[model samples]
Each structure stands twice: as structure tokens, then as C-alpha cells.
Target: MAGALLSTPNRVSLERLVQVAKERGYTAQGEMFSVADMAKLAQETLGCQAELLCGGLGGPNRDGVLQHLITGHPLLIPYDEDFNHEPCQKKGHKAHWAVSAGVLIGVQNVPSPGYIEDSELPGLFHPVPGAPHQPPSFPEESSPGAIFLLSKQGKSWHYQLWDYSQVRDSNLQLTDFSPARAADGRVYVVPAGGVKAGLCGQALLLSPQEGSHQLGLGHLPQLNPAH
Candidate 1:
């Protein structure tokens, strides 16, 4: 996948995608991708068939949806009406891309917040865990969790996710901070057990130490099992 991304054509397309994002009021640091934008990145930019898999509305599949992203699946989560201040709430939904840079992180098109809102914005969407404060503009609701996964089956491509219970069913546990390091010295975590033997869990790693873009395939870190 990394090789394909660096290929001249795909690299050019990725640059174009970034340019389009910049034109849409997004910043060079991070950007939001609507369902349509995600589709474009998958099909037109990445050249893969993309699907928007939702875990339904709120809570239930939260862990599963998160696991998908943690394991290298690409996803885009849209904020729901649950985000908003009184009276004028529920007016709109905003979304951001879920990037798996060894570890899963959410990238926003808007700026970071100054204070924490009692809402779900900082809790669920921010790249790093913990509340920095309420976002300047993104007050999102508890998301149902939406993600995109790509796989090549036979002659074409397919997008899929864990069957919601596979993580627990497989007895897979997440090691938030794995000790193994990537070629770039970045660390990531991988599941020790899987629903089936020999399953390759996505190596969830730490975010970049410094940088604006953290979702690139520049470093495909080696996976280190928790066990």
C-alpha cells in the first residue's frame, strides 16, 4: 500500500487531494473529509473502492469502530446533532478523517480548542487523548463511528470492518502504548490474539513527535505483538 501511494501517479493525486482540501477552508496541518471527500480519496486518489461503514448511532459499536482504525483501516467520522449549544444546536454535522499512524488519531480541518466543552468533541475526536478545552467551532455529538477499510479480493477491491464482536470474540486486547519502534523510531501496538490464528492486527502506534501531517505511509512500522 505504501509503495502504491508513493508511485508517481498516486503521489500526484495525493498532492491534488491536499490542494483541494486547502481550497475548502481547510488548513495545511489538518483537514476534514466529508463522505464524498473520503470517496474521492479512496477511489480517485488512492484507486481503491471505498465504503462508509457505520457502527450505527452512538455507543454500542464504539470499540469495534475504533479497533478498525487502530488496525490500519481508514475511516471518516461525522459529528452528529449531539454536538451543539442550546437552542441553536443540531444545526449541522462535521466530520474528520481517522488516520492510523501506527496509532489511530483524528485530524480536524479547524483549529484546536481552548477549553473543554462538556460535549464529546475533545473526548472522541482529538488526536491525543484528554481534553484541551472546547473546540473553537467543532462541538460534536457522540458519534456512531464511521470508517473505511480497503482490501483486494480476486480481481477487484473490497472495504470491510471487524464484525463488531471479533475483537472481544477473538480475545484480542489493545496495548495502547507498545514498546516496539518503527524504522523511524515511532512505536505502535498490535493485538496479541485474534479471532483466528495468524490474523494481522494493525500496529497502533504513537502519533508523530513533531509535525503537522501524521497520517502518511512514510513509515510502515513493524508490528510487535502485546504478548
Candidate 2:
């Protein structure tokens, strides 16, 4: 699905992609798809270059994601499924992949103080009768912001709005899949138990073979941050 979204002017079928991956030996246990596998698929099927942006301590951080998005490159983010739902009867961690659509940064309104007297000129300013002397100020810190994710549920794909913290935690908590490249130069999946390490802020950025096609800020819709 993500490949299809990124491969504009060219259409790619999921069945063909699976067939190609199987032929290239990119799948795990001949069925599962890993981040590396997907990267290889994107490279071969879409004629795009793949770059893995991984953090030192965790899966890709918020800054890395935002930077890739700013460059108009959509990301393939794999994370722990527990981040989205409460643990049920499942035993081990389950990992899921999603495509980043965009981010949502809320617009903060700053109230006016109405009027104030000038310190230098005594009669230069006048205060409104009902206006407060000073209006409340917002904090200097930047908002963490939320993200738009294109994810699959059951057999259908949906767009979800998730808090950036959830995405960050999920990516860091992944413990079911690890990236690995086989001897044949195929990116194969390594069992998390064998590796004994999580993805640690890993994400894949897909760029066209020609060059990056940047998305203007005007193309994104204005939305409030998710609570």
C-alpha cells in the first residue's frame, strides 16, 4: 500500500510484489515481511532508493520522522502492536508496519492585552475599560504534534490519527523483528529472539530514482494536534 502511494504515475500490484519478493528471497519463513524486505521491494518495484534512519538508542525519533517528511519522503515505520491496543491473549510481541502520511501541528491563539500606557510618554497610551492589563502567555516549548498513519486493519486499510508519543513508544518497544541482509544481498528478516534487540528507532525512507519530489506546506491540511 505504501509503495503504491509513493509510486505515482506507475502502479504496482501487491500480488506481483509478493511474487517478486518470494523470488528474491526477501520474505521470512516464506511469508512474513520485514522492514528490510519492504525496503528491497520498494527499491525493485518502484525504482526508488531506500535509506534506513535509525536512532542510536531507539527506533527513529520524532525529529528524524519530521525531517524525512519535510523532505517529501514518506516513511515505513514498523512498531509493536501493543502500542495501539491493550494486551489480550497474545503471548509474544507482534509487530506491524504503517506508512506515515503527514503530521498535525495545532495553531495556538495568543490573546491581546488590549491597551497599555507608554512608559516614556505619559499620555501616549490609553487602556480599554474591560481589557485585562496582561494576557496569559503560551509556553516556549514546541508541541510534540500528532501524525497521520496509513495502516491496515483486517483486510481494509485506514487512515488513523495517533499521538507522536505512541508512535515513538511503539517503534522503540518493537521486539519481534530485526533488520538483516542475507549473503545473496537480499534483506532478510532476523528473529528478534535470536538478535535479542529491538529495532531501536529504525525507519525506512523511500525516494524516487530520479530525485525527491517535495510536497509544499500548502498541500497539507491544517489540523489540531491529537490529545
Alpha-carbon lDDT, every model: 0.31, 0.50
lDDT of 2: 0.50
Model 1 residue runs over 4 Å out of place are 1-9, 12-15, 18-37, 55-57, 80-90, 93-227
Q: What is the per-residue lDDT of model 2 for residues 1-227, given as tens digits with 9 covering 90 to 100?
A: 56565656578877777788778876644444345566677888877767655552123244445544544457676655554442111211455556775544332443346545568965333334445444223222234542333333223345666656666566665554323323346554553433224243556777555544633222221112111
Q: Write the per-residue lDDT of candidate 1 for residues 97-117, one digit (tens) a residue.
A: 222222223335443654223
Q: What is the lDDT of residue 202 in candidate 1?
A: 24
Q: Candidate 2, 179: how far from true, in Å?
A: 19
RMSD of each: 18.3, 13.5
